[model samples]
Target: TKVADEKTCIQFSIRRPKLPSSETHPEEGVYKRLDVAAWLHHLNELGQVEEEYKLRKAIFFGGIDVSIRGEVWPFLLRYYSHESTSQEREALRAQKRKEYAEIQQKRLSMTPEEHRAFWRNVQFTVDKDVVRTDRSNQFFRGEDNPNVESMRRILLNYAVYNPAIGYSQGMSDLVAPILAEVLDESDTFWCFVGLMQNTIFVSSPRDEDMEKQLLYLRELLRLTHPRFYQHLVSLGEDGLQMLFCHRWLLLCFKREFPEAEALRIWEACWAHYQTDYFHLFICVAIVAIYGDDVIEQQLATDQMLLHFGNLAMHMNGELVLRKARSLLHQFRLLPRIPCSLHDLCKTCGTGMWDSGYIPAVECTGHHPGWESCPYGGTVEAPSPRPPREGKKGPKVPRDGFGFRR
Candidate 1:
């Protein structure tokens, strides 16, 4: 008989369970891991009394079993909300598949000129990252591996899918782990889309979003660790940039930690039950873990960057998460929270304070009472007065629906 083809080999490799049979075997009784039965129970009870919180806490404290990540990730990413019934989730999946197909078809029909630029960028940028991303792992190892090709296809598809954001460095890192768990290319693509919209908002070429996140990070550090924040600031302007952390925030530490640990951190961050910016607290946790070293050693900006680089691939995910929770608890105990941080949390719809604290009020921009509101109120509601003659209003960017033009 003739040997199996490359595509067949790739499909076989991807379809294989990420976890060995022994690990998933119930007879062995791995109590810590979330199993299929438990997942189904949570699925059935989603949007019920405290079900979302309980499920999130389970995943946060103990990650979804390797066997179940593919099923669990979609829920965590909000591709299917907890409120959706089984039938509703199925319908949503169908709708998403149709949307993805349209996007793929659009990519295929792009003119030669349009394809040329993307192809060249893919060749030099994305392809290079694909080869190096998780190469040591068996999933992507070996020459002409189908998994590698799948990654390339997904990235290329994403480039066309969201031209405004386009393909950027480190995206391959973000998508590789997702693909490792989610075998179906289309499912992986949509999961990735959800991930980008929800957590990875800083990938666009526009700098405003990233700048805002950095501002939040800076404020978080100052509020949480004043001495270290001041020490870093005293180093110089470059010190304040926190350049070492850009990857952590943008990619959610995907490159910084081992694959398994990164996935655990991701699930915890996706919970968003605590705060939309919990990831920032995670950053604080990592910093607190190493802050003593930096302060004691009197490391300057460059030295601190070197110190952080060394910590990559060595930090403990669970320990950091625990520390992050502590930091959040401390933040809550503060008598007064900064308005900027409060506004940031409000913008993301995350509850920053305890239930007793005044809930964030939506500013209509027209409300006279908004001035008294501590939550940075912007007058977005139209001015009561009409525009003066010959004066033009601010132009809103036309929504291209992810098309480049």
Candidate 2:
């Protein structure tokens, strides 16, 4: 069995497919999956595509198929990059396995007195969430299901792996889908790491990181939908708290959308071809989609919370994706973006707001940082900038649900 598994991993490495060409863009309004042939082609040309930006473009336009998600998500998450050769990738797989095992061993070896309170908190928090992570989904449902045990092991191990951000409430929600798809414990662990690395602000110890994200989300609203921003502001600082939108940003809307649809939304956000903050744009799209209802109904803060909370398990993922794209197009056409916002874009390394438009070259192969993609292209490091000082808003509780105090 060991030999067979190694052979399978090697085959996956060598026969990795190339991303579909731009000419193969899915028909308008169609959601195309990355098929077998396309996957094989991408693997064959992994080295060449790494030299360019084709893979990112392909994913941006067409998400990976559910069948290939286990294979494709690793690359998307930067577990593997375009530049890795078949041999190098196999080696990486082996090394990653050993590293993950070591992390698990360390957790076992620790004396209870060494990290008692911290480990207990992590274990208790994770245990509480695991049973409820996605109980409605068959994958995690049932008493004493093996899959549920797998989820528990991975989350506990993750807490040990990254102690800095140990076991936040929504982390289980974020990891559940990856575990459902990847199935393998180690691969899922690494993929979850990749995801956290991309959205680390969501789980940072400092409230300032989350605060910055919320501030940016608000600014984005003010820019793209001034009326909505004004309406929220008119409600006072508590209203501007945007507690409802926090989980959408924090968990990438994983809790709000159904299991399958949440995966689709994540693939789009992970593509990062449109904007680094495309997920934020998706939030704006959601608000825009239901904007009329809020306006006409004159929703107070409590009422707004009720409305958004109810939207969970009820959103149209495709519609929200389409509207996000439309909003991006509209944002690009603005005459001038504020320098502060541009600085924010640079800090996020989205490059979307750099010129108030996505560069045409992003679809082409010549976009900036193509060379550095493998080393650090997944999420661009924010450039150094002066500290931003804005009128401080009221602090909201950090609970996963968005409800102001």
Candidate 3:
């Protein structure tokens, strides 16, 4: 098996596809507050409407300025449509405000017994997670901070709104950044809703959904980094399953990158300029760029987990993003894309293949990493408890660290 794998690896390396043209763009600075106005100005003019494409391209190349991130993220997250006029958006905002108020009122209107049931069931989990979400951020720091309470409120409302999906542990991590950016509770709630509903990465993850994504990631690894894939496959199902990337896919790298850089990465991902499955490329990029030595060292599964865990806040987000973009370009240029890959692309977004077809890649039936998805797993729902006094990271694995099962 090793000999055949090595031969296959070499064959893949020699035959790796390349793009016909490798055009490059100059590094433009962050899209500033003025740029937002410019885009909106074009939108307001009768004959001079701006294309969402230009804005998405700008964000894909250069990230948005922090000053304008709150303004821009709504469009990126699909909270606000690009075609909507200021007047229409104002009406929409009023409508949303009313809807939010109604949601809040539903909580107020719950019977004493119903309230007890909710607190015992849903709000209990939200309270525990919100306090730990981003306590280190100044906005959420200190005792009895109003922002913390606001976060709790927004999350509770979300639980009430989305009772079927309910509150999950990583949700607070996702909501905290939006709360910090948007500041207003109603807007934050709406933005979080948009994020959960629209984006591919953030979801009420099911075990099947996560396994499907890992399978796609495995195929991408096999295609782009054959030697690494061969080494992983040699280690049996544990390696090929890429369980270490669960955190990356589940939380969208919130714990992996620095706070600012994580925010930047999220916006770039939400831009939807290239592919909805860019998060998969990010998974590939991390292993490709930093874990290149995994195959060389022949690290086992646990050691690989430890190595990736230690990369939290240490990775260059910009560099990983660049590598991911390059890998996507390479995948698009492949001569005969595999059928499974085509299925992945079509499922993810518009298929990126040019033409030609090939049989699906084959693998052993010993798939691992199927314990449960980050969302589908049974987590202990801590009872409604007091917020922790000081700042601390979420109690989950940051980058596949401390995850054993």
Q: State each model's CA lDDT, in order.
A: 0.67, 0.66, 0.69
- Name the regions of candidate 3 deviating beyond 4 angstroms: 1-42, 46-49, 204-207, 347-405
Alpha-carbon lDDT of model 1: 0.67
Candidate 1 per-residue C-alpha lDDT over 1-405 given as tens digits, one digit per residue, 9 for 90 to 100 = 112345332110101112233212121222356677777776544332137776775665566888978878888877777777767777877888898888888878889997887788664688788998889989899999999998988888898888777788888888888899988788889988888888743353355777777777777777667777878789888888888787787777877788788877887688775577778888987887666667765676866776677778777776676667656645544434444566555644434444545422233233355556445533232223221222232222112101110
* Candidate 2, 1-405: lDDT as tens digits: 011333232110111122222212223244356666676676654332342245555665567778888877887788877667777877888999999999988888887795687557788877788888788778888899888888888888888888777787887888888888888888899988898887433554355677767876787777667778878998999889898888787787887887777787788778766467777778887887766556665667866776777778777776677667656645544433433245344534433433333211111122365553322222322332222223232222111112111
lDDT of 3 by residue, 305-362 (tens): 7667777877888777766666665554333333345555554433333233321222
Better of 1 and 3 by lDDT: 3
Error of 3 at 375 (Å): 29
Most accurate candidate by lDDT? 3
Q: What's the best-to-worst order under TM-score?
A: 3, 1, 2
TM per prediction: 0.76, 0.76, 0.77
Off by over 4 Å in 2: 1-31, 45-52, 204-206, 347-405
